[model samples]
Target: MKLIDITNNHPKLVNEQLSNTDAQMVKVYSLGQTTVIYTIAPTHKDLVIINPKRPIRDNEIDYVLQRTIKAPLQSLEVTHVGNFVEITQSLKKKRPTFVPRFS
Candidate 1:
């Protein structure tokens, strides 16, 4: 599936929404000491519903973490609904890999 790297300033509302839909918080990579890579679960069945004003439920967070650890790469699809944005996971083509060579 296509891997989409999440940005650092992706709005706390978005993150909160992810938490609501059971979006597991995977690996967090430090980038330039400011940015981080937050990987989530990859399952076609899993979905992350976003609500800007509403807070994420606790049970959803637990379910997300449980499923994320078991999956490989997480799939996320972003869509805007009203004033909220939904991030859902779906089956997509595998992402490409890049290897750097030393000079």
Candidate 2:
């Protein structure tokens, strides 16, 4: 689903919006060429995010966020790129395999 494009221009407003709604922003990253995503933590209700303070569909997207999470995911895309080979290649890195354990 499309997320309210609240990129990190104004943190205070975003915090207030999330706090007032009792929602927490878990992460903010790009999904692909144009798609910026905002992943939210589980809460009593759906999230209502602050509008982006500035333009997010620009070159600053640095697009790529394909981790796993357990909650509703929202996205916004620029939808102009035809080739994602470079984008995929750039984000492709071997991550250290670390499994966490609790005592």
C-alpha lDDT of all candidate models, in order: 0.42, 0.36
RMSD of 1: 15.1
TM-score of each: 0.22, 0.27
The 10-residue segment of model 2 with minimum total lDDT is 83-92
Candidate 1, residues 1-103, lDDT tens digits: the string is 1223454446574577467755455333221222223344544443343334454444433344344434433334544454333344564657879999999
Task: Using TM-score, give the best candidate's number.
Answer: 2
Using lDDT as the measure, which candidate wins?
Answer: 1
Distance from true location, Cα of 15 in model 1, Å = 9.1
Q: Which residue pairs of candidate 1 clash?
A: 1-92, 1-93, 1-94, 42-74
lDDT assessment of candidate 1: 0.42
